[model samples]
Target: SSVMVELVGQMKDNLLLDFGEAKKIIKEVVNVFDHKFFINRKYLKQEDDSHFQIQFEGPKGMFELQVPKNTTYLLEGEATVENLSSEIIKLLAPKMPSNVEAVGVYIYEGYNKGSHIISNISR
Candidate 1:
């Protein structure tokens, strides 16, 4: 009877150890999966050779983002933008003065070559 009691105690400890290790492995796997989804483009776009190629590259301001003509980006979906560099402000200030308040985002796009640029200003 005493032997059986000791055996049960040992089995409980073994189960606890196994469960702890399993939990640790699961947590690590979950973290890796999240990183791939969130910051990395691992699953964001369709997998193609073009997908792997660079799309847009520029300094943080006055960027020319290619978009389908007349497409609108939702106000809620705006991505983060840092303080506009002085170079960017110099180009913009001449057009829209005073009203270009701090912490505002202005999105502008041109359709065809030499077409008038339509801008959406948000604050």
Candidate 2:
């Protein structure tokens, strides 16, 4: 099993139509992970038009992704930060808006970490 890792990142402001759009996109990605992963929408919460949080669980372990209307996102899960970050970017790229240029992700794991730039999404 992999150690738990947290990934924090951001997108351009107003990158999503609304919290619903964010949830839908997330659900799509989660579903792609197969039946082992399921979102717990009951925990869904929104502080305002610009912020939202979604939680889910899977074989990898509990996962949480937060989108703060400002387009900032935080994702925590059980996996190597780099591997998890890349997997997310790869899955999300095809679903993102055509205008999205890139997403910057910073990883954290027991005080050891690094950053990644998932660019050329439109490509």
Candidate 3:
């Protein structure tokens, strides 16, 4: 979910010195995630001038959580990668409804191994 999205943003930020480099950095990071997470920009129906955007799964891995689509801010500091994943699981586990859907798991590989753990809701 947001974990990947935020992580992608972080990757983009860490490698990019300015907006001009965002695209390159984003593509590089997405490749590591195997193109699972992607940037999304959506119009917010609640506010005409607002928008709800995110970088969630695109193809590689799918989400299995049942969190209601709400803008919840996740922490990004002082927590180990595994701990962060645990935190996200804790927050989302209770919300997971028993049904036909894939379960959540951290995408591992390269530096993306455990640093940017993430989850998402699926249809």
Which candidate number would show the highest TM-score if scored against the true structure?
2
* TM-score of each model, in listed order: 0.20, 0.39, 0.26
> What tens digits encode model 2's per-residue C-alpha lDDT throughout 1-123?
122212223445744334576567756764454323322336455556766676667699997776554443333434345655566667766666655556444444544455454545656
TM-score of 1: 0.20
Which prediction has the highest lDDT against the true structure? 2
Q: Which pairs clash in the backbone of model 1?
A: none
lDDT of 1 by residue, 7-51 (tens): 011234335235455345434432332212111222132334322
State the TM-score for model 3: 0.26
For residue 2, model 2's alpha carbon misses the true position, in angstroms, by: 14
Tens digits of lDDT, candidate 3, 1-123: 223322222223345235444345444533433312222223212322233333344387643332223332223433244544545544443333333122243634355345444444453
Off by over 4 Å in 2: 1-16, 30-79, 110-115
Over 4 Å off, model 1: 1-17, 38-51, 54-123
What is the clash tally of candidate 3? 2
